[model samples]
Target chain A: MGQPAPAVLLPDMSAAGEVSLESLRGKVVYVDFWASWCGPCRISFPILEQLRNELGPEGFEVLAINVDEVEADARQFLADVTVSYPVVRDANGTTPLAFGVMGMPTGYLVDRTGVVRVIHQGFRKSDGEPLRASIVELLGE
Target chain B: MKTLTSLLMAVVLCGCETVQPWERGILAKEEMQWQTNVSEAQLRNQIYASKEASSGGAGASGGGCGCN
Candidate 1:
């Protein structure tokens, strides 16, 4: 068994609407904590989009949680990226603190059983390979 | 005064040792001092924020501030 996912309620994606960890049960979820002003975040965003498209229908979900303090910047970033997946906003970082996120582009992959299996600290192109492999493994491929 | 000068020269000679590029393998070990310092990481985080527009690169390493 992996680490149990901590109970936390994330903010709604300002561009879309509300979403929560509890609502995403029964799927392998990749939770990415980012902001509009982080460079590594910008680079990893596309990879995340690709993962969502490639593995999404196979029960993999990407939750891009924005740590931007302002709603305007978050909205502008959404327009900038054109991301299709939900981008939740952490207006006060309550959820971020609960998740122990240390830096931008940090990712946590929780299995369908709600056990967090992988915790990635940064975004190097090298980081994505392991992440993808873990997702594929969890999805039973 | 001459003894002091000799002692100082000896210390300087001992301090002159340098590590060549290949010798850096030991320094590159994880336990070495080259690990990312928290303050330096914050400075780089600001650079990252300015260049990429994102935050939260390492867990609990950042708190929301105008710094990034």
Candidate 2:
């Protein structure tokens, strides 16, 4: 729960500019690397949305990066499950390489100080329990 | 003949090394998958199999047309 997280700055999918994990400093960040083709990612999308809405007042932010070669695929998925959290695209997948993301729905929970507290590999409906505990613990810290 | 024998031996030895959990980061990449682009590849393979009347390795069972 104390390793420094790698730097990640990617083009914003919802806007015309770039957004960096650096901007989310001082806030607990849930950095999720996902792709449209991954089935597990479909499960995590709504969980992240609920968490972001619930913990946003406690300075929690979700930075979801989509690594789809075709942006339309991501958009289609978003149409099914929409999220208000900041969404970004890493078409070249360069950011995930730095984070050592080996799977489709890998997530890094960064504390307010920008230290990685957890690396969750997959997503399940029941996973939100422990994930919330970790987020709550960090929020308490 | 010796080179061919060694090549066969190497092929047999490929699966001997078990990848450790910590060393699986590279092994987990999307591109490292057998089907790097599964959806697209699946559709393409299906179309090819249907057209050619020969289909295998598509993972799904063949349809009534005998396509893979």
Candidate 3:
């Protein structure tokens, strides 16, 4: 899991432009692949937002990659559960293909050096503690 | 005959394709479910199980009275 993260360039759901993973190289990034239909994502989003807010000043970033086929579903989901992090839309499903994502709500933790250290699949309430610990360790590094 | 059967089997297997995780949105749609109406399907299963005097094979287990 130490490989460099695959380049991601997708339409920014939060703003008018695009967002690229290359621009966030120096920060510890959590690249989360999610969809509105994914049940676990509803639980994961708020926790991820909490993590981002808590660790953001320390250079931790959560870049959400939405893989919803219909952009309206994603917008509806965001309207219900809001987050301040930059959310990008991979409506064509290319990013998940490049990442070889096998399940919904998968996450890749990329260290400050852009190397993927963790590939997390499926999220639950109990996963938050360990995930935070891992991010903290990477930030320490 | 054996060789022809094996060839036919291979050809049949070639028609199957694995659905990738990201492409499963269509499958997750309400219209794609085998039983879109959950309560109706459950009731049908319950009645069938009651008639057969069997339970627990499909979904939730229930008594054979069909009351469940």
Candidate 4:
């Protein structure tokens, strides 16, 4: 059985208002939990960004949440790696806690119906291929 | 009576500090985390160094001992 994703409504660092996972129900949503200090998170961000850019028009969205307690640290990280997708700050670390994130750079792929199709923890370059394939397949559905 | 006692002992021995999947969310809470104890460690090291008249890796350039 597909599990429904936990409710997520967080402050957008780049925008003025909050962005909710509920608002992204019809799209294939990728909910990412990342921290600036996590080494693998640095490796995963650009690759996930590419996937989002390539598949975004096909009803896919990447909602990357920065779990740094200090929002400025996340901003500094963004300065080094610029991505097009909507990025939000979970300064209180509430969302990652809710998602049961044991490590940094955890990702949850939700289908269009808001069901969690997959959960990925940590990332490598080759991991993107399988992830992209899954995204494409989800888009086809 | 012996069999019943053995069964109870086996069950108690098997159940040592295993957190379930659903209960992991509580364990993942920020308050339940120990990563923030780095400062506590730093404080301990500083106190030890001060008492021993030794200063090393105290965020400054010093090759006092424990390999920089």
Candidate 5:
């Protein structure tokens, strides 16, 4: 909130695709930085999917940015996990570095203006209630 | 006689190989090699960012370009 939040334009699943934080303006966005091999990341994927489906129509978006080195691995992981949100493959993890991610499964709740309101780190399934509450608050705001 | 004593010592040492579940507490200590404390996390993150192509884990603040 001090300086402007870092801007990240990440690659989308489509061959010619690219998505940017700036493009997500006017909607509440949840940007999650994660890797395929991270255990906690695997654990939280389903919860994220639920959030996306449950709140998508309400202008909520979940962007799962995979930090895997290989695009195939990222794709395979998503295939196995079956997440409903957009899975951005950061093969080089450029977006993650721009966001200063120090931990796996770190999520940024950004409001409609592209301003990050809350940062959630290393969340567990048990954290579903509190995490949902934070997302709701941002959505309401 | 000396060979028998050496064999007895070997068995005693080998018997100590098993680690009980309760003893795992010591293995789980913050001071242990696998244990991560605040400072250690910082160092490990720095190392991980530099060495690994992928990023993100748990705990810590901010982001960096070390991995990219």
Candidate 6:
């Protein structure tokens, strides 16, 4: 999309802290908006974890935004499928509005410079390959 | 007359509100589904289909057999 990703500042779901998009400016970031009830997200999480693990040392980062109104639901979902990436909670939901997210499990590939290069809506098993390729290309830059 | 119709349409459209993507979690809840219980829905659908000799469409069309 070639648009600068909107600034996201939200509480980290894991620890007693917060995470922001600005902090990850130097890395190729995957900004994913997800909810516990989103079916595609269950599929997307593992693949995202795989990408993060494989490409992390190369400066690839995943910043997941959980949009669940009930934090417990998200925690339960995460308990079933865990990821090492920094997962933040946007309980107020202002972040998704800033991103103009139109569907669940939306992903924005933010290159090192903070501009969103790709917008992926809904995920399938086949999408992992292309998403990986995009991140790899961005990291190569 | 056209101005009055346009005004009416605008008034009606004003009642419509867009539910943002993230807010759809409530809609995705199990209680919000048309049939909250999958097994119960399946059983009801089976009975209805057997009685009417039709299935699917949620009452959109009759069966080809014209039994209805």
What DockQ does every candidate get? 0.02, 0.07, 0.63, 0.05, 0.02, 0.70
lDDT of 5 by residue, A6-115 (tens): 78677787446888778888888888887765668888888888877888888899887776655676677777888667777666556766777767778888888888
Give RMSD (Å) of candidate 4 vs. truth.
Answer: 10.1
Stretches of model 2 off by over 4 angstroms after superposition: B1-68
Off by over 4 Å in 6: B1-16, B53-62, B65-68
lDDT of 2: 0.84
Interface RMSD of 2: 7.7
- Residue-wise lDDT of candidate 6 within B1-68, one digit each (tens)? 99999999999999998888888888888789987889998677667776767755676455635344
- What is residue A39's positional error in candidate 1, in angstroms? 0.7
Candidate with top DockQ is 6
lDDT (Cα, tens digit) per residue for candidate 2, span A47-133: 899998999999999999888767897888888888999899887767777788866688999999999999999899999989999
Tens-digit lDDT track for model 4 on A78-112?
A: 99998888898776667776787766678999999
Q: What are the lDDT figures for the candidates, one per model?
A: 0.74, 0.84, 0.93, 0.81, 0.73, 0.91
Between prediction 2 and prediction 3, which has the larger TM-score? 3
Per-model TM-score, in order, reads 0.63, 0.68, 0.86, 0.67, 0.64, 0.84
Chain B TM-scores per candidate, in order, are: 0.43, 0.48, 0.63, 0.34, 0.32, 0.59
Error of 1 at B34 (Å): 24
**A1-141 in candidate 6: lDDT tens per residue?**
898999999999888989999999999999999999999999999999999999999999999999998889999998999899999999888999999898998999999999999999999999999999999999999
In candidate 5, which residue pairs clash?
A: A100-B62, A100-B63, A100-B64, A101-B63, A103-B56, A103-B57, A103-B58, A104-B56, A104-B57, A104-B58
- The regions of model 4 sitting more than 4 angstroms off are B1-68
> Candidate 2, which CAPRI tier?
incorrect
Off by over 4 Å in 5: A1-3, B1-68
RMSD of each: 17.4, 8.8, 3.2, 10.1, 19.3, 4.0
Candidate 1 chain B: 10-residue stretch with minimal lDDT: B20-29
**Candidate 5 chain B: 10-residue stretch with minimal lDDT:** B20-29
